[model samples]
Target chain A: MATGVTATAGTTRGRSRLRAALRVTAAVFGAYAFAWGIAAFGSALGALAGLAPAEAVTAASLLALLVLPVAALWAFAVPRAVMGWVLLGGGGALMTGVACAVRMALP
Target chain B: MSRVGGPNRGTPRKGKLISPALRAAMLWPHTWAGVTLGGLLMLVFFMGSLAVFAQEIDRWMMPATRVEAAGVPISLDHLSLDRAVRPVVERLAAGRAVRDWYVQLPEPRRPVMALRVRTDQGNAGGMATVDGTLLPPVGTLGASSFFYPLHYSLHLRAGFVGYWIVSFASVAMLVGLISGVIIHARIFKDFFTFRSWGQVRRSLLDLHNLTGVLVLPFHLMITVTGIVIILPIVLPAGVQTLYGGDIDRFYTDALGGYERPRTGIPAPLAPLDPMVAEARRLWGGGEPAVIFVHNAGDAASYVRINRDTGDRISLDVEPVYFDGVTGALLQHRRPGPMVATHRVLSGLHFAAFEHWPLRWLYFLFGLSGCVLIGTGMLHWMEKRRVAHGVRPGVGWRTVAAATCGTTTGLLIATLAMMLANRLLPAAVPSRELVEVAVFFLSWIGAGLHAGVRTVGNPPWSGQCTAVAGLAAACVLLNWITTGEHPVRALAGGDWAILGVDGVLALTALASWRVARRLAHRPMRMVAPTNAEVSDHA
Candidate 1:
């Protein structure tokens, strides 16, 4: 009876640890995606403007697209990815904020 | 008593593997999380899938309008801005209380110059020839305009409820997808394997998993983009904190300056033809889709040109402001780095710039997502039958009915609504309301039929019949109402309408085949197994 109780207790502890690890991974991935999206948008803009280093800007945009799925998959495995996810989400929020600001400031 | 004669005599059973308390905790989260949000997710996927062909549907439904591209080069030479400005202003001010006015020039597919004026009471717009004679108000509810908006915003009471519902569904979908992947670690190995003739449960599981795995990338992209699409609404608290709670101000800065109305006194204006010609010089001869005139009949009046080329998503032509009287080019508003990025993202999400080929691909992907959601629901019901240790009860039955009704019934309802469009009187009061009523009524009728008639029978055959019937009706109705058979329409170069009918006929044929197969199948009565359990879970 004592052994059975100990075994159940050990399983519960292991699950709790796994849950914590996943949460942390999600945060890190969210942050990475957020930064990547902003950078990608900037590069795309540079490509449009016919500015210096145009080729590099185009390359960066393509890279961002390729990496997005990988980062999302990583978020599923590690809790740290959550940070990156949150960061990307936060960036989207910022862009939206800027849009709203521009709308109001205009005549 | 002999052990052979006991109740457990012939059984080779193991003891319970999981404690009751632990099982309850684990199962509670899975059941409530899935059941609570499953219906809403189904609605989002189904509507979004339909929205993939929104533009094509628009072309099919509004067949009365005709546009012939005039390859006339826009020239500023001998143009008079005076004639165009004075009349539009006088007409707009005289007709109704104005909120905003938009003017669009002739393009390849839409040759008539269009003016959209939103009034205090409701939205009203008109298209006219170059000479300014008004055309009849176009009928037929543009599924692209109505359904696309409703897909994301649900077109509910002011779109608030719809947005909230979609946001919640997105979050739930994210959770479900994550848990589902973790549960099925061997997802890739069996990616291409599908056995249609397996045990009932295994087949169901296979369908759910196959659809989910095959369209996994599309599902993720759509879900993430959907959240990104409404980032502002979801995180308004942060914006309010940073921007002093003035939402409009924030938008103006983000989107660049709003076109401010000119304070200068009114003056005689030049003809619009000259300004259009000037715009063409800058935009390289592409037909302008929209022409925004700022400060009409004033010294500061500016005309912004938006081209309608099929390749580029963004209207990249610079806004060319002109003097109303002099027709001299004024300041141009060029797009900066950030603005261009915003436009590209918007274009991708809306599929605004896609050709027919890419649009069809989007349609297929969207339909696959819908199938994924529908099969997910079916898998849930199958899982519950095994887990509950009881015969499928009223709750399971209700979900089954709803699943059949909402997924297949929605397709049926759409066809019925299209049929109603042709048969109903054009001048009937509240035509939109009547059309909506027909749509809902048909859907409700389908649900009631499925619930009563297919309680014990396999639901797939009934659903297949319903979908096939509606699709067949759609084809027939198109022929009867339009007075053009598919072959005749195709030969006459009316491809859009004919294509719509052909697609519906093909869908009908496919559904009929599925129904026939279901009817002939011998092993249709067995309960589902664990493999299928994981498909839905």
Candidate 2:
């Protein structure tokens, strides 16, 4: 309801221009943090799953590298820039936490 | 809006799901990103496609290399390896250190045996026949060393700034591609949409979208893999953290974990035949392409034998090692999973380990990527061309000229380099430098021509005509200079030259067709009416 109201408050062009700028800014951070976090989480998960450390690190890094474009898509497709960033941060944190917990618990 | 609201009909009403506002929001970034970096991406894709045939281009450039390649069997008995290694030894003896030199033996892939010497003085070496007879200087840096570097380094004027620029453009392309998909209402259904004879801007937009979607996955993978390959230089944190900042150690680990130390003791180098025999024996069957003697003539000298690629999809050429003094084998272990994965990703980007069929496929897809960028740029410029009042503003005019310069100008520049290669005397000092100069100079000329050409009279068709003529001239000059034109090259079973010339002829024909289309377009750029404005919107 608030999104609809704020969206209607301003002129269409002005609101959209501001939103577009924010989207691009948020996306750059989302892409970087997501890329780094995914690699870390992947390696942790792989190590816990009994894969060789080198193999796990490599496979995880490579697969995570592919998520950059999709992450960009997610940034744009969301209803707002803040929501997109929140999702990126939340997902990255969860993955990193799970990966860390798995390493600590198993070892 | 003609083909909307079907696939996007999820959240109750169409407006609720993907509102008109959302579509416009996506379009803003998509258009800007795609337009701004489109030209550079076209260059990257175009040169990258050409680089796939780098070895083939080397053979075409140096016609003497056509008969023997690095892959074919050659008699090492008459190879006279000592004579080839003498110059580097002499250079080192003179006190100025010889940087690096290796015996690139004659094989079917790169037939001539090149001593490939590099000292502080520069390339003071030449190619040799199988019997060690000196072949004349090959003149031009094969498109591999010259034109192909443009793909990554773009001339090194600012020292690898080109690579970083390309990397950034690729990221923009990634973001733009994703936004394009989000904004697009019909993706799979509009896969085959190309209305060539329809209203001009509509036709171009449709064509751009079609090519963008057609090779979408390939473009994505290629862009991603390119970024991955450059990550070492771009984001060094991974290596810094992992290896504790020792790059050399990281390389050693990646290369199956072996590094030899040089001991200063005068010793005669062992004959390479025994090491070659041992490597062949160990590997079942494969010819050695490179015979690298490290710390040559030193007590700690070791020889590494690298196998040429054949019928494999890997960039990791497992090297076989041997003691240079004793000719006894010294083995290295296979690569770890991390290294192996890196090699595969790089191999996919380089596309080196493939036969001609796969190379052609990569080339075709790469050209399609160029088309996607070119068509997208045209769509944007076409709208601006019509929307303008009197003569259009400076911004629109600059973009108009830039569009022609990058598209047709790049073609002109590439062909001009090949022409310089043929015409420039090999004995002329810095012959390769002259050829590269011709390349950049011609590109500048094309840009100037496009900039001065009047509005409403686009410079495309004229520039394209020049491109066609220059391309045809390149084919002809090869015959005049080398006596190895496409017809005779084909007759002599020299497919390398044949393929190069054949592609040039086809490009000429295609350019001419483009020119003809541009020549026939009406004076005024077609104005999009209120009805069709929604199409772009």
Query: Number of the top candidate by lDDT?
Result: 2
TM-score of 2: 0.85
Ten contiguous residues minimizing lDDT sum, candidate 1 chain A? A52-61
- lDDT: worst 10-residue window of model 2 chain B: B1-10
lDDT of 2 by residue, B1-537 (tens): 111111232243454655555565566557777777787888888898899888778886777666634445565554545664454345433565454457777766666767765555664567776655566767778787886888987866474587778877888888777767767777777777778787777888888889888888888878888887765554433343344446556565666544477677768788777677788777777666777777766778788887765646566677888888898888755677776777777778888664677778888988898888888888887776655544778877887788788889899998988877878876889888888889889999988998999476458889889989988998898889778877787777777788889999998999999899889976664554644443474
lDDT of 1 by residue, B56-93 (tens): 56655654444322334432232223455335534645
Task: Write down the RMSD of candidate 2 (Cα, Å).
Answer: 5.0
- Scanning candidate 1 chain B in windows of ten residues, the lowest lDDT window is B1-10
Candidate 1 per-residue C-alpha lDDT over A1-107 given as tens digits, one digit per residue, 9 for 90 to 100 = 01122434666656545544443344334534443444344443443445432232323333443344334433433323345446556664564455445435433
Off by over 4 Å in 2: A1-18, A40-57, A83-107, B1-26, B64-100, B118-125, B157-160, B386-390
| Stretches > 4 Å off in candidate 1 | A1-107, B1-35, B66-99, B105-114, B118-123, B128-133, B157-159, B261-270, B277-287, B294-304, B313-339, B388-390, B450-454, B457-460, B519-524, B527-537
C-alpha positional error of residue B193 in candidate 1 after TM-score superposition, expressed in Å: 1.5
